[model samples]
Target: MTAPHVESDQVRTLFSRAMSEMYRAEVPQYGTLVELVDDTNRETLQRHNELRASLERSGDLDRLGVERHGAIRLGSAEELFNSRRVFAVMGMYPVGYYDLSVANVPVHATAFRPIADEALRRNPFRVFTSLLRLELIEDEALRSEAARILAARRIFTPRALELVGIFETEGGLTRQQAEEFVHEALETFRWHGDAKVSLDVYQKLHDAHRLIADVVSFKGPHINHLTPRTLDIDAVQAAMPKRGVTPKAVIEGPPRRNCAILLRQTSFKALDEPIIFTQANAGTHTARFGEIEQRGVALTPKGRALYDKLLGSVRRHVGAEGIGPNAGDYGAELAERFKAFPDDWAELRAQGLAFFRYSATPAGIEASKRRALPSTVDGLIAGGFLHADPIVYEDFLPVSAAGIFQSNLGTDEQQNYTGRSNRAAFEAALGAEVHDEFAMYAQAEQTSLEQALVRLGSPHVARKAIA
Candidate 1:
């Protein structure tokens, strides 16, 4: 007898339910984490009038809600684009660009970055999508073979397609229809059918499929990870190991010197599971629990500068060359100019110079450094760095993401020497184009500030600030 066919709506419902269930089952300590955040928020409100007032002014935690991060994978651009439509129906949008392909430790793949906190607060769900690079496959025969196999498979069911169509045609479903669709779509993804095979082989295939099905199975698109942010990432990191949850690394973000900024993250290593697969000879086999990897990346000033510079270059180059510039001429000129620079173009752009240059520090540089460190989150707030008002976190750290993925996977394999694909190839596969995460975060923050001003019956106050 064939297994029951699940609808897209059911798949969505089950996906959410299964994710919650899985978290509860695998890392029971996550329950503690959730409770801690709630307790901390409550205690903070009760103990500190200032904090309570600030939260009230900015929008209460109830309004912001609990932040969560999640992970998922897709098989192709079509799936990625279609999934974007589905997420839009639920009120989420693509925010940041992340390149994970260069992450060489263990988990190596490209993905999109974080969503703004406001967007997240409005709806905190964010998924990092990845696609395999067929261009990276050196062996043309293997690449072709894999591509053929992937083309024949269908990751999204008919129901998923229908649901996406509905969401696209109609911004969203009615309350009842929305609930039903969410339920089914979540379920379809979460349901694991019975397929007899060995544990070891099954794991290999699963890992391979994660990489293969993405690119091989329809031009490569898959949700790589779903991530949630917490103010206490450091606390979470410390607690995980104690609870038998082996994290790939410690929290990665700004230094622990007490500052509120873009992001910090850590994750438990991926868990191994047994599975069944068909052999080449039409024989059945089992796969054992294989390795899973994870890793983390912090955005140092240098790193952030690099990131910004790259973005600026892309924008400037795009504007100068136009959308459909001759690839050969454009690449050649850009390469030549880039090579002429001593530092990275992005870094140069960030430093307010076309070349490396730094003025000597004043005589009081040491005394300035010795000033009392900022003790509270509020103390660290500054108009320049922290913004006049609190800004929502946006953007993903690719290094951090690669850290998470690598910590859970097997050893990273060297790419074929004969073929190498760069960041552009990976971005193309994602389908839903990536944007600057920090910019998105800033926009959300500005929106909230305006909203707060309106709520306070002082629209002019916000207008003056903007002016």
Candidate 2:
């Protein structure tokens, strides 16, 4: 006799719920942030009928409430390797290699998330995991010391690793095993007040880089921040102060737009929590914070190139001024430069600037039954037989991520490190190749369009021709 195995989606949902509860308990301010976001989302939905209709049509409305992303920093290759296995049991795979060393953070990252449309619609929980690049540390001695400290510590529970092995040997975990696995896995990300290093060593690492100190000093890589999705991030940003949470100076990612693109994020300041060193020294650490995000349509490569160019212009203007709270006029410059990008959904699609999921309308299905459907996608859409909705962007922005890291790390100095994008090293650490996020989004759009076309026969030409 065999026990029934739990679906990976169910396990992920369970883990996401448990993680939220644990985080809310650990950081009470996060609970308040969540409340503000929930309120804002409801208000946004009530105010925008078109937006609500679009969400319902696209099947995104239900997932919006449960969607969230979390970030964690691992200290070594082995920790990352094992963490990858754990996430796999929940059907999450590493996607998109992001090198944050460009921001002088000394860590490169990948987002572990569900890639399948059904799985994503089920939970859409993401963990933005980063591996510390110790070699980037300028001081040879400190780098070696940091490595030694990381090597000695275990970031995962023994039972979690055992469960992972079991899942790999078998196909999946039984309900009981999965329930236990969620508890054990949660332990790996749980916050610890006790430091693994001495106060003096921590300060030395902190002097080298605040991020280095954070990764090497902690017992485990506690989740730095958990982000809840919001329909209107600017509204949440405005509402933060009223709720007693001070937000970072400017939102990261694109400036506010009528039809939002990519990801827009804002976070309250990181909390200063009490920590006791191994040598009985008492101090405080600022690592965990609350973040809110508004995810919009995934851009096409051409669209992304334009986005990068416009953002580059903004950063060029920001030269030496910094992107922190006091980075004067950064927001104004970003908005002014982004005017080159299209803000209308129809224009974005026609210009091949965004990815969209195409579906057959009820009218289209009825027309197909009578063999009255148009042969071209544009014809069908123009005749109100097919509907196209933007596919959600489910990845992180590198500069936006670094900006959030910098603001929460509470630093005035924008440290510049002498290193470049090392995708090989990041992939080697994880023991797997990272997925191309753009490819993933493209495939999703293509698949949806194909399925809809199948319902009403293939189209000879599509306006965007994702098929």
Best by lDDT: 2
Model 2 root-mean-square deviation: 1.7
Give the alpha carbon lDDT tens digit for every residue of 309-381 in model 1: 5433643553222123442244344444444233432333233222111111222223225542233212222
lDDT of 2 by residue, 7-30 (tens): 999999999999999999999999
lDDT to native, each model: 0.42, 0.89
RMSD of each: 13.2, 1.7
TM-score, per-candidate, Cα-based = 0.61, 0.97
Model 1 alpha-carbon miss at residue 219, Å: 16
Quote the lDDT for 355 in model 1. 16
